[model samples]
Target chain A: MATKKFMFLNRKAPYGTVYALESLEVVLIGAAFEQDVSLAFIGDGVYQIAKNQNTDGIGMKNFSPTYKALGDYEVTKLYVEKESLEARGLTLDDLMDLTWEDEDDDYAEKPSIRLVSAAELAAVFDEQDVVLSF
Target chain B: MKYSIMVNEGPYTHQASDTALHFCKAALEAGHEIFRVFFYHDGVNNGTRFTVPPQDDRNIQQEWSKLASAHDIDLVVCIAAAQRRGIMDADEAKRQGIDGNNIAPGFRISGLGQLIEGGIIADRQLVFGD
Candidate 1:
């Protein structure tokens, strides 16, 4: 099968409804089908990646931690909007797992997830075979 | 190329619907035919006929109606989503004894098969959601 590029846009706050979780599942399925997958996080969607999220208070399982495993699914083209991060006072350090961040401060090492402007990310939407947002 | 577009976000609740509307317009402008636009999840709200916003502002529901009417767009609302949200058609409203129907004109209740079919027929299926 030909490689199909899939772009995912996440725009909701994590854990409110099942939208964010369902979006993640679709991206994983795309990856499983050997598609090239990229993710764009914007607005309240940034909350989906906040580190050390505690869901116990709401009696919900902590799903935020599962995001760190995206790389294992071969879904590495992560792009977080700079505006969303700055609006929430979230640095890249707050998104990646503490262990991963600790191991990769050096530029010689593997760079962390990429951050792109909203316009830059939107420019690539036309190229994708599919675009999923949730 | 035929296209399938899924909208999972509610209009007036977020920017997702606005973005999706713009994209739909652009898709048409680019000369790509859209096979269908599927409203699922919270997106079912976009088909509500009873929304009355401030008189000073533009009404989103009316705007959606105009878009569909003017372009002859196939506006489909997922049956499951609409039923769950209490957005019922004239038939369902009668059975449930509702005084008013919530389904707006220019939109129809549809099954998930419409979405799947869109994917099969369209060159691309893009989703805009929560």
Candidate 2:
């Protein structure tokens, strides 16, 4: 099949629901098909990649580390809405440093997180052929 | 145009499944082709054969089965999600060394790849969920 622009819209928080983790599973499996895959974090979804997430007391497996491996699968584009982060009293420093290696550029690591405004994210969403929400 | 559907919630609890069913019926009635209906998360429960709703109420699983039978639609349940929720077919149940299977007709357990493919193969894909 021909590759299409696929975006997974994450609008929910982490562990309280299964959407965050299951959304990641679809992204990983979708990567093997080599589509133009991107992930957008909006609303409470921005909390999914919050750094230093310790789930020991919650008794749930911490899957935040899986976001780091997304780059390896060539699922590079990750857009986070700036307004959402600011609304939740968070800054870029609060998120994990997710980056991708540019194989052609001497394997230099480049940031994958593109913090955008609501308007900018709307344009991104308009370009997708498919968008699945979690 | 060809379309694909993703259902993220199960029967009765959330309206996602019912909404998807109505949309599918409407789409088919309008002469559009439905490439597939991929059920995931709690939506896998829609494919269980053991669900027995009140007779007066709509039988969610049976409705999907009848739709699939009439339209030849592909109803796919994610295997990983099904295993987590115990929605199994005979093959899956036997493979897992279990005694019984509860998958409804017109549905088959597959992989997340099928979900991705549904999006890729169809002209448009719709997701019904929270």
Q: Give the DockQ (2 decimals) of all models.
A: 0.17, 0.89
Candidate 2 lDDT over B23-106, as tens digits, reads 999999999999999999999999999999998999999999999999999999999999999999999999999999999999
Error in Å for residue B129 of model 1: 5.0
What TM-scores do the predictions have? 0.57, 0.99
Model 1 residue B27 CA deviation (Å) reads 11
Winner by lDDT: 2
Error of 2 at A61 (Å): 0.5
Each candidate's B-chain TM-score, in sequence, is 0.91, 0.99
Q: For residues A30-108, write the lDDT of model 2, one tens digit per residue.
A: 8999999999999999999999999999999999999999999998899999999999999999999999999999999
Off by over 4 Å in 1: A98-112, B9-121, B124-130
Give candidate 2 misplaced runs (Cα > 4 Å).
Answer: none
In the range B13-91, model 1's lDDT, one tens digit per residue, is 8777787788888888898787788887888899998888888976777777887887898999878668778788898
Clashing residue pairs, backbone N/CA/C < 3 A, model 2: none
C-alpha lDDT values of all predictions: 0.76, 0.96
